[model samples]
Target: MPTIVRASVALLALGLVVAPDALALSKRDQAAVEALNQQMQAAEARYRDAMVKIANADPAGNADVDGALEDMEDVMAACAKQKGCSPTTMLTAYKRLLKQNADAAAGEETPDDGADDGASLAADVPEAARAAALLSADGQRFVKMVQYNPAVQAGIRRWLTDMRGPLIDTYENYQYMRQLMWPQFERAGLPEALLFGVMAKESNGKVHATSRAGAAGPLQFMYATGRRFGIGPDATGFDTRYDPRSSAQAAAEYFNERLGQLNQSIELSLAAYNGGEGRAQRVYNSTGGRNFWDESVYNQFPAETRDYVPMVIAAAWLFLHPKEYGLTFPKVDAKPALLRLSRPSSIYELTICMGNGGTRDGYMRALRNLNPRYQAESWLPAGTTLSATTRMVGLYNRWCLQGQRAELASTLVRSNASSAIVRTGPVTPLPAEDAEIEGGGVGAAGAVTTSPSVSKAKSKPAKPTSYTVQRGETLTAIARKFQCDTGDLAKANKLKAPRFAIRPGQKLKLTGCEG
Candidate 1:
C-alpha cells in the first residue's frame, strides 16, 4: 500500500534512532552539517507557510509560493549532494534545535498560549479531550488509571464542580451531532472517545465556534489546516469548516496522516494536531522514536500541549465511564428525520414553538446540529425540508402548526422595530386640503405632485452592479436578499442553473437585471 503524505503534519518523527554508519563525520564535518541543517529548516518553514497561504486563498493563488518552492528545491539538492546531510538528518536536527529554543524560551511556568495548541491549561487538560470504548487492554487500563493521577484528579474534580455546566453542554451537544461526526472516525478506525475528547476541548461541540486565529467548526479547524483536508467554503458560500461531517472527516484524515509518519502514538498524533505536525514528528525522531509521554518528548512541546495530551486522554476515559466519576450523561432523543416546513419560519421561531416540553434544555442546539447549513435566524421558505430529529417533528406537530403557540411564535418573530418602536405622540392627521407633494410640482388642489426628476428618483433604487459572496451566502438567498432575479444573478456569475455553486471570496457581476 502507498503511504499517505499529508500537506501539513508530515516530516517530524522519523521514528528511527539515528545510528552512525561505518563512515563517521569529524567535528568540522558535523559543524558544517549543522549549518546546512539550519538552512534546510528555514527553507522548509518558508515553503510550508507559502503553501498554507495558497491553500487558504480563494483560487489557490500565492505570489511567494514559487520562490519558496525554489528555495526548497535548492535545500533538498544540497542535502542530497552532501555526504552527511540527508533530508531526514536535516529535519531531525531542526526538530532538536526547535525543542531547545522552546525549552530555553519557556519559563518554569509559562502562560497558556491557546493560539497554537488549540487548548489551554494542564490543569484542565485531563478532562478537556477524553473518550472511551469497550477496548480491554493494558494501554486502555493505563488510560483509565490516568484519571486517578493527581493532575487528572484535579481536572475531574473541576468537571464535577466548577466546570460541570460546560462539560454537560459539551456532552449534550456531542450526542446530538455524534451521528454526523462519529462515522468519519469509525470508518477511519480511529477511536470515538478521541473524537469526543478533541471536540470537547476544541469547540465544545459548537459547530459555529470561531477562534481568534480563524479556526471554526465543531472541531475548530483553522482555515489553512482545513483547506489542506477538503474543508473550506462551498459553492453556496457556507464554510465547510463549520460543517460537522466535513470537519470530522478532515480531522480524522489529519490524525491518520500524522499516524503514518510519527511513532504511531495517539499522544504524538494529537501533539501534531495541537502543536504543528512537523514539530511533533521532529520531536519523536529526535528522541529515537520513543514515547510522547517521556519527559524529554513531553517537555519539548509547549506547556499547553504537555497538558493537552493527558487531558484529552482523561476526557476520553470519562466519556467512556462517566458513572465511575459520579457523572451521568443526559439521555437525548436524537433519531434523525426530515422536517418539511408547513409555513415559512426561522429556527428561532421553530425553537420558540417547540418549547422545553420534551427535553430538559430546549431543542435549539439539537435543531442547529441536525441542520448545520442553515443559521438560526435564517428564514426557510414554506415546504423546505431540513435534516431534523424525530422529537423535533413531534414538537412541530404539537405546537408550531397554527395554534396559539404558533401564532405567538410568528408574532414574536415578526414583531419588527416599526411596530414596537411606536410613535410616542398622537398620530398626525393630514391637512384638510390635499398635501402638496415636494419637487417643484403643482396639483389641481393642495395635493402633492411630483416633478419628472422626482418621478425618476422615486423609482426603486438601482441595484449594486456587483457583489462579493460572503460566508454562508447562497445564490438563491442572495437574489432574495437583493430582490434580484435568481436566474440573472446565476447567469451574471456564469453559474449553472439548478445548482448555482458559489464560494466565499468569489465575486459576481450583476448582469441583465435590477434588484
Candidate 2:
C-alpha cells in the first residue's frame, strides 16, 4: 500500500487560492481557471522532481532537508493568518503539517538498523536507479525534515499559496531538465539529483543562463574543467560544455574523480565542487574528519558555500516530496533522448527556425542552463552535434535551417552596402522654377528674403570646424558634445541629411558651433 503522508495536507491548506465570489464562476469561466490550476499543479510537480533528482544525484553532501521542512511550515502559518488565503492550498497545508511533524520528530530517535541505505544507495546504485531511489528517499526524508522544521514549513506553505504560477513554472522547467538528463547521469554513476541542484544554483532553470565569472553551461563547468573531461575547446571556439550530453558526461567524470579522492563521501565531494577541494578538505580536517554538518566544518567554508549546501539539500528534499511541502512540480512535454544536429546553428537562430514554438526556448534555456562553459558573445560553429531533450529536437532542427537563411541574408546585405558614398556634390542654389522641379518646391528667391545677419553669414563661407569621432562614441555623442543636433551635423558634413553612421577617428563637420 502506498503510504499517504499526512504532512501533504498542511501544504494543501496553505497553497489553495480562493478568490472572493463577487462574480459567480460559470462552466466556461472555470474552464480557463481549471486549466490554469492544472498547469500550476504540473509546474509544482516538475519542481519537486527536479529537487529530488538533485538530492539523489548529489555526490557531495546531503542537503538540510530538516531545515527546509521547518521553513515550509513557517510559511504555512503566515499564509493561514492572511484574510483571503485558503489553508487548503497544497503549499499551505503541507507546511502546517510539516511543522507539526517536525515538532513531533524532535528528539525521537529510531533504533539504528545499521543499514545506512542512503550511504549504500549513493555508492551502489548506478546514476539512473540512484536518481529514482534517492528521489523516493528524499521525499520520505522531506516529510521527516518538515515535520522537524517549523520555520521552513511556513515559508514553503506561503510559496505554494502566493505566486503559485511562477513557482510552478520554475519547477516545471527544472523537471524538464531532469527527465532529459537522467539516462546520461545513470550511465555516469553520478547522482541525477545533483543536476537540479546545479540548475538551481547556476540559472534557476533559465536557458540563456550566463554567469559573471564566465561559466555558461547547465553544469557550470569552466573552460579548463570542461576540456579536462573530454568536452574539448575547439578552434572554431566551440566549447562542448554547452552540449548537454558532453557536459553531463564531463561533469560525471569530474564528480567521480572528486568522490574517489574525498573518501567517497558525496558531501565532501559536493563541498569541493562548490567551494574548492582545498577548502573542503580543510573543513573536513577541521571537523576532526567528520561529515559536513560539523560546526567546525561549516565555519571553515565561505558564507556562500555554507548557504549553498543547505539550499541544495532543501531543493533536493523538496523535489522528492513536493506535496509534503505544499509544492507542485510540473511535467514538461519533452522527450528522453539524444538530439543530433546535422548542421551548426546558434540558439537564437534555432529559436526562429522552430516556428517560434515553446520547445525552442525551453531547449535553448536548458543548453544555456546546463552548459556554463560556453560564452554568449560567440556563436557555436556549424557541424556540431548537440545532445538535446527529445521534445526540443524538432525545434532545434528548425532553428538550424533558419539560421542558414539568416546568415546568408545578413552576408548579402553586408556585401551590398559597401563603404563607398555616392554624392551629387554640394547643393547648388538654382532659380526658383528649377529648384521647384529638382528640390520638391520652394518660395520665389526674392519672396524668401534672408535676414541681414544670415545673408552676411552665407556670403562668407563659414569657418570649417572638424571633429573626430572617438572610440565608444556615436554621432549622438559627438552632437551632444558640440551642443548641436545630429541632423545638423550630418547636413553640414554633406554626408547625408538627418541620418549618419560614424566610425572611430572619422572626421565630421561641426556647423553653427564654436569648439
Candidate 3:
C-alpha cells in the first residue's frame, strides 16, 4: 500500500488531519502496514534522486519530481479506498516516527538555526505543512519558509505546471556556472538554494539577461540597487551586474541587508528583493512587525510582489526538497579546463562541433556562462584559450579539429543571411585571357606585368597539392616552380599578383598547377 506523492511545494503547503482510529493496528494487520511502508520508501528514494539536481540547480530534475508526484497522487487515491488506513493517517504515522527519532537525537544536536543536520531537520519538521531552517551536516543550508498555506500551495501547483520547463533550463544554466557564483553565497553565509531560486526566477541563470524595468544579471539587480552593493560597470565597459560572481556576491549582501531591516524574515526579505526595499519597509513598519504572509502585510505589497514572494519561496523550497516533489536532477560533468583553439574560430562554431551527447543540454549555454568575456559569434584567433568543461575539451579535440564536423561548423557559423541573397550591384566577371595589368595587379593569364619582386623561379618537374612558402619567396616563383598558373595560386590564397609577397609559414593552395 505505497502512498502517492507529487504535490511538491504544494505538498508542503497543504495541511491534513490524521484519522485517530488507525493508531492501533493488530498483529494480523502488520502485513498491510509493511506493504504500505515499502511503497513509501520507494517514493522517497525517487525523491532523493530528484533533490540532487535541485541541489545542482539542474532543470531536468523536475521530471523526476513530476513522476514522484503522480505516484503519490495514485497512492493517495488508493489510500481513500483502504478500509482502515488513510493517506493522512499514514503520512502522519511516518512523520511521528521520524519525529521520535529526531527527538532522541535532540540530546546530541539542536534542530534549527544551530547547524541542524538534514536528518534532524527532515525528522523534526511535521513535513505536511511546516517551515524550518535546514542545514546539512556538511554545512549546506536552506530555509524552507513557504510551508503549508493555500496561497503557497497554489504557487507550487503553478510551478508543477507552467514553470516546469523554465525550472529545468534555469537549473542547467546555474549548474554550469555554479563555480563562478556559489562561492559568493557561501562566503556570505547565505543558502545556495536561495541563490538558485532568485537566479532562476530573475534571469533563468542567464548572466546577460535583463528585465524591461532595467534590472539585470543573474540576480536581476537594478542600476542603483547594484551600485549600492558594489556591483556596476567597470572602467573597461564591462558591467559587473553581468558577471555571475560579482552579481551573486552583491545579491548575497543585499539579501543580508534586507533581512536586517525586514525582521530577518526570508519572505519579507524576498518581497523586498522583488518589490522595493523602501516599499517593503514601509509595509513592515506600518503593519507593526506583521509577518510577510499575514493578510494585512501581504495585501500592502503590489500584486506582482505578492506573487513573486511565494514563487521565489516555492522555487527555493524545490531546490531544497525536489525529492518531495518527485523531481530527479541530472548530474552534469562540469570539471573545469582550458581549451585552446586549433584554428581561428568562434564560440558559435565550437558549440556546433562540441555536441551535447555528454550532457542533457547542449554546451552552448555552459560555454557562454563560463566564458562571458566574448560574444558567441566573436572570432577568436588561433591558440586563444577559453574556460570550458572537461567534456567540451575532449569533444573539441575529437570533433573540432581539422575534420568534417569542424569545417562544417565553421561554415555554418560563417553563413550570413545577407550573403545568401543575390548582390544588387553590377558584377565584373573574370576575363578569358590576360587583360590589362593595372596597378601591378595579376593579369588574367596568370602573369605579373610589373613589380619584379615576384621573380619567376627555376623550373621543376615535380608537383604537389600544397606548399608552405619559405622566407623571401614570392608567389611567382612558387607558381613557376610548380608549373602552375600564378593567378590561380593568388586566387587560392586570396592575394593579388605582381608584388605577390609571400611570407614564411604561409600555406599556399596549388590550384591550377601542372607538372
Whole-model lDDT, model 1: 0.66
Per-residue lDDT for 395-477 in model 3, tens only?
A: 99999997899889966765545435543333344353545555644443454343233244434446577899998666655
Model 1: per-residue Cα lDDT over 2-52, one tens digit each: 111111112221111122233688887678677777776786576556534
Q: Each prediction's Cα lDDT score?
A: 0.66, 0.50, 0.67
Q: Among these predicted structures, which one has the highest lDDT? A: 3
lDDT of 2 at 461: 46
Per-prediction backbone clash count: 15, 89, 20
- Number of clashes in model 1? 15
- Model 3 TM-score on a 0 to 1 scale: 0.57
lDDT of 2 by residue, 338-379 (tens): 555455344444444454355323455555444444432123
Error of 1 at 81 (Å): 47
Model 2 lDDT-worst window of ten: 1-10
Native-to-model Cα distance after best TM-score fit, residue 355 in candidate 1, in Å: 0.7
Q: Is candidate 1 or candidate 2 better by TM-score?
A: 1
